[model samples]
Target: MTTEQLTIFAILAITLGLFVWGRWRYDIVALLSLLAVGLFGLIPPQEMFAGLGHPAVITVAAVLVVSRGLLNAGLVDTLARHLTRVGEQPWIQVATLTSIVALSSGFINNVGALALFMPVAIWMSRKGGSSPSLLLMPLAFGSLLGGMLTMIGTPPNIIIATYRQESGGTPFGMFDFLPVGAAVTLAGLLFLSLIGWRLTPKRKEEQDTSKDLFEISAYLTELRVPKECKFAGRTLHDLMAAVKDDADMSVVGLVRSGKRKALPSIFEVLQEEDILLVESDSDSLKTLLDVTSLVLAAGEDQDQDQDEEKKKKKAGEWNLTEAIITHKSILVGKTTSALSVRERYGLNVLAVARQGHRLRERLGKLRLEAGDVLLVQGQEESLQSTLNELGCLPLASRGLRIGKPHKVLLSGGIFTVALALIALELLSATTALVGAALAMVMTGLVAKDEVYDSVDMPVIILLAAMLPVGQALETTGASDLIAQALLEIARSASPAIVLALLMTAVMLLSNLINNAAAAVIAAPIAIKMAQGMEASADPFLMTVAIGASCAFLTPIGHQSNALVMVPGGYRFGDYWRLGLPLSVLVLVVGVPMILWFWPL
Candidate 1:
């Protein structure tokens, strides 16, 4: 290898090591690698930041914003509501849920699609008396499968399209991916719904039932002391003494006149009308209320009064929702008390769950972390803004809102028009998606401020940063060298065998790194391999697209997989049990489908 190739390969080796080690965040690792290549003179300084402005990057960002718009408009929720009525059989429920997730993913961000359906899956699992593990993994896997169905479905497809464009060919059109993608998605869905779900380990009994999976009712509830309460003037310690031994409750905080005193002193005296945030179970809550004669602050009468007050003020329209913290979230490492969650944003943190465990720390004292699911109650408009500002993804609620049909139709119409524009070659994919996203904002389907928040920064950064690194591999002839090695291995084998091996290699790489990065690196090699074999580049390129989306066997492989791990109560090893078979099925089915659609 030449010196430049050696340098590129070494940088990639360390970068991949850090990614697999996972000690540092992926975006940070990617950015550092990008800078390293620039420092080594592999990538010209003028073109170092070009990836950030690439059409592929723009399309990914616009697609994410549009996905959020679809979510905010309740288009997916309306569909899920109907699916809930598709009978209670485990197989039927899994089939319906996975199918919807897969279909939605094709049009929007796959992770967002999975997030929208996760709560629905959990609710169905509870109703059907089955472990969420069975439904969640399939839902996640379906999201991955669905992304292959459209040009804008996943980042890898966009990356491949952009690569094709750079090679002096027209980028893949809107429906170019449909045939192979649809066939694979259909085959994968059939396996998951019928036999694959059964292969998932049953861990319902192993999960902690004390806390609900959704953390809806087990949240920290605020109770107000009524005038008729018997412990009106008693100190915090004295009141606790009354029910300390009888209930599993703790005084999390004391909120008086809208101000909070977290972890208040034991000698603090409680007055009538003081709202105490208590952490306890249902039975313990009832016992505490009976012992202290306290009433829930959110009781029916109070809620009605609050509603009336909201109408008068026109500012207190609050909603209860759950959000997961992303790696880029500013809230990480800061305690709720420090951030003044309630005081600053007019929001209340009801509960926080991390890695399937309900944190017992005082709500205010608990420091937020990436992947922590927070149950927050806040004003509807402000809540969405706050979660976005804090870098959190709001999980869709199980309850459907009124008038969803109108918003759903409006959002669907806008997205469909954009797709048509792309299909007709009237606009590029990026331009079309940007117009659609702006239309969603203008129609009030997605809030103006939320447009930027809808784009996942980590994903965008990962893709942009890795683009030049991929260029380095190509320019240094490293990609050509690797393709030749593969050609040698498959020299005697049939073209079909060569195609399967190439797909498997890309799939394995995708499971280790970001799928977008895998695609950027593997796409060039695929084209080179096709050239060496004197075959059309279409089949090899299609193989790269299919393999890049097949990120199964590890939670870290894809965001959708990671999103399901905590909620599903899945251990690291659990994914391989079902993912391995699904992957094999993809290779078994995908090769034939690709050759059929775009023959080599």
Candidate 2:
């Protein structure tokens, strides 16, 4: 091999190794690789930073920010609140939740859609007395399947379309992927709801009543009413309703004059210095206190009007409940001190989920990752909003979103305009998307600070770094070598077999590597293979796009899988049982669909 080839191979190997190893962060790895390539003169100095400004990379980031706006605007929340129900049968709940997530994903980020419904799914499972494991995996897979339907649904489709542009072809239109994406998503959803969910391990129902199925700890807490509290003069019933409607808190009982009252009457007048035994978590309670100016009475204070009046302005009395950080969050690499999560989003991390794993140091300094459930305490609204912003799926059985419900049309309209422009080819996809993101910001649908907060910087860097490497491969004729090898192996096989083989291979690689990386590496080889076989390139490319999206076997394969890893309380092995079969089902259904739609 030439020195350039050998050097390139070594760099590629290290990049793959580190990404799979999950020790160093991906963005760091990408940045280092970009630097190495530049130092070696593999790419021009002027073009070294070009990947950072690449249209594809920018579009991905903009889309995420826009999706965040849609989320904040209460688009998904309004729908989810209506669709998610209590006391339904497992199948009924699963069907509703899965269908909603899939349909929602076609427009917004699939992971975001899943995150919206995760807490609701937990509520359904607990109410129905079924295993959440059975339900959540299906919900996640449904989101993944649904995202395949549109250009904006998943990053893989966008990446492939961008690749097509670079290779001198028009990118796939918004609905071009729908014929195959819809077929697989519909069929996969059917099998998953019918058979796939049934195969999940029955851990939720089998767990002891003492332990939460998600393994999160619940706490009892007291809220002290300051003189300024909206509830100070209101009766217990009115206070309870107000709390539920605005503050995300519930009234467990009332405490008056140093005595705890069990189930106080709704008409009981809440007064200053009265202690309320609220059942909500620290985060929710904090938000309630912040909004209503309530305090957590730490001491046995029978202190009446004077002390309560003096303390009314102090905002620090909000109760602190603990939450465990799951291993699956974007917060894995950050710390409370470093990330300034409390100041930035107004949530405090009270503890970490070692999960029987040893902690080397203080919890405050430890960086979090997927499966590390957090024990946190904060204001209810801020905490819930923070959870949504961080892309951390909550383990609690409650729903939360951050927009006025009546503004749904505005949010949907903004998103629709952006999508329509891109879909109809009136503007570049990147321009239309960026325009939408700005609109979301300008309209106050999403906060200015949240624009950057919603995006995964690591993903951006990975895509940027890998783009150059992919270009290098294409430029160096290495893709041709790999494609020739694939063609030689598949020469004796029927075209259908070749399509299946390519799809299966892409699927397995996606399970191992990042989905975008898998696509970046595989798309060119697919094109080359199709060229050599004298076959329609569209089918082969579509096969990779579809297969690369079928990251059903592992959490690492898809962002959506990792999003639910801890909230669902899943083990690494837990995914395979449902995902493996679902992947097989997709291949079986998808191959034929591809053959029928964009025949090889």
Local accuracy by lDDT, each model: 0.83, 0.73
Per-residue lDDT of model 2, residues 398-507, tens digit only: 22232346568998999888878877899988899999999989999888878787787778888888778776666667778888887788889888888889999999
Expressed as tens digits, the lDDT of each residue in 402-489 for candidate 1 is 2244488899899999999999999989999999999999999888878887888888999899999899888989989999999999
Q: Estimate each model's TM-score.
A: 0.84, 0.78
What TM-score number comes out for model 2?
Answer: 0.78
Question: Which ranges of candidate 1 are over 4 A from the true structure?
Answer: 208-323, 375-405
TM-score of model number 1: 0.84
